[model samples]
Target: MNDNNKDDKTLNHSRRQFFKISTALTAVALTPSYILKAADDNMDDKIAELFEKRDLNIEVNGIVHTLSIEPRVTLLDLLREQLKLTGSKKGCDHGQCGACTVHVNGQRVLSCLSLAIMQDGKKITTIEGLAKGDELHPMQAAFIKHDGFQCGYCTPGQIMSAVACVREGHANNEDEIRSYMAGNICRCGAYPNIVDAITEVKQKGGTI
Candidate 1:
């Protein structure tokens, strides 16, 4: 009877060991599926990120640039952040102050209100691009001669708009210049000097 009891104990220990090994094997087999699913999820995220970015090619300051950017990026952000062209001010990003004015296809548009994706394959001109190698543009020179700015924060936008004003034949008289340039606000009250600068450029009638 002692030998039979010993045999029963051995059988129980063997059963316990067998169950432990079986459970470990099952867990090991299931872990690979979970890992594979996690890997697939990560791969899907990577694919989504890739799809969200788009290729953009634009010409700025007479130079062509190719960029990969998100669709929601603004033209001001693209110019200042990516291209390092910070001449355009960001005051009143809501398009009320006209501080971010720039030329698109020879027409003035608020850079903050414009999207970068919409400007793909289009021409853009900033204040930095307005000058030649060592000579400033005619409008810039006139602004310097007339002191059209006070703090100089709004000078870039002002100069850009002034150039457009002359090019579009809107600088005929003081009232017209004021009416056309009403979008640009000078907190320092430099309206008189700004008018003088635009008038000088228009009288000269040289290439703006």
Candidate 2:
């Protein structure tokens, strides 16, 4: 082939390859949308088939929460999604981190690990319910005063555990407080401040 003719042919091949790659990329991007739409449609049908309207009577904070919750809903999901109380965070859904800690019948329990049905007719106190009108709980106040949190992702759990620790008389000393709160991990390494908050609350005779 002539040199000019060969160069022209190479340019044409490159243009065709570029178009082919562009088309492939477009299809690849659309594939995820199509799959997501199909999955959403399937979920809608399953929800309609499985979900039955029923009343769920449970006490949240101090008031009775009467609403319908799916049988498969976890207590943590119910609290955050259904009730719109997102104070109890979902750190470790497997009950490892105490982020989803809340008072169930006056005892600290991992809300993520509990079923909504199991907490029926029991008193539930979330972090939102800890404060009284405008006054924060002693632990919450201590947390703020001592700057017990860095990222604040683990602060809620730390505060909740601190409340329980004091109420259960586990915060008799710094070492005991640390040992008791060892279950609730803080990625920010705010253990000293957390222990200080717990100690302050304990000194004041605070109860959850």
Candidate 3:
């Protein structure tokens, strides 16, 4: 080939390579900035809005706690996230599952469905508050003795419901107990032991 033709081809190739490198470097430099901006936007949206944070005063496990909480925060989230009492599980945040069940003013309530603001001035009792100084309640002891749980994910709710069931006179018989506890589904299929635990607690005149 002629020298001039060869030189022209080399120049074109060099220009192509330079353009490719420049494009790639521009993309790489812009990627992190775009990602950072998206992350910042997400953080801003997640920041609890000023007006949403409202003052909350409630008695939890016999202790009165006062703090500001988001209006959208559920009672379960308030206990687990704000107060750091994680004994209540977050199964089925829509209240279909009873893992988040707790006692509100001595009544069994689905914490996941109840709002923190709605529970103001109410007494809240979680699994952590069920026992008294190394002494398990009769229902808890009965559950342990009867082996009422396998994975134990739903045990807290089951126990809590059992206590309330007895208190509400719903534990008249095995069928009654089972029917009343139907709301708290135990995935482990420990229904028999759960009934036995409830029966034992009832026989002992135990009240939660």
Candidate 4:
């Protein structure tokens, strides 16, 4: 009788082990298909995304550049990251501060808001391009002479907008200069000096 009892216990243990193994196999087989693909195929998708760039041809400062870049890349990133032009500041990248200002096709634009992919065959001018060899642009010289910048982080944008303001013939008076240059924000309260610089340049009346 004791032998039969021991045999019954052994049979029950074998059945339990079999059921546990079967349950585990069934669970694995029933896993969602998307989960399986995410574990293995998603990595390949990310790798492919890294190479997903389109051809871009644009001019910077004065030199033409042909590059392949992702469509999401902004003009500011293309200049600062790829072309190594760091003069354009990235303050308030929401197009409010105007720090990332640059000339796009002879018009002032916020680089942070402009996409690199859409600027094909366009001319872009940054703060670094505002000067000749060993000579400053008239606006730049006036800014220096009048002390237009205090912290200097907003200087580039200010100068770009100032040039545009003068070019647009909106720098006729102090009020108009302030109104036209209102897009740029200088934290150091250098408005008077900036107005002076723009006024001086406008009075000179030469090509900026």
What does candidate 3's lDDT look like per residue over 23-73, in tens digits? Answer: 435434555565445444553222213223566789999999977666888
Query: What does the lDDT read for residue 49 in candidate 4?
Result: 36
Off by over 4 Å in 3: 1-50
Task: Please give the CA lDDT of all the candidate structures.
Answer: 0.85, 0.79, 0.82, 0.86
Error of 4 at 114 (Å): 0.5
Q: List the candidates' TM-scores in order.
A: 0.77, 0.73, 0.75, 0.77
List, residue by residue over 1-208, the lDDT tens digit for candidate 4.
Answer: 4785566557555654554445434334655554345434434343333335666889998999978688889999999999999999999889999899999999999999999999999999999999998899999999999999999999999999999999999999999999999999999999999999999999989878
What would the per-residue lDDT of candidate 1 be over residues 126-171, giving only the tens digit for each residue?
Answer: 9999999899999999999999999999999999999999999999
User: How does candidate 1 fare on TM-score?
Assistant: 0.77
Task: Please provide the root mean square deviation of candidate 1 (C-alpha atoms, Å).
Answer: 20.0
Error of 2 at 206 (Å): 5.4
Ranking of candidates on TM-score, top first = 4, 1, 3, 2
Instruction: Report how far residue 96 has shifted in candidate 1, in Å.
Output: 0.6
Among residues 3 or more apart in sequence or in different chains, the pairs in candidate 3 whose N, CA or C atoms overlap within 3 Å are: none
How does model 3 score by TM-score?
A: 0.75
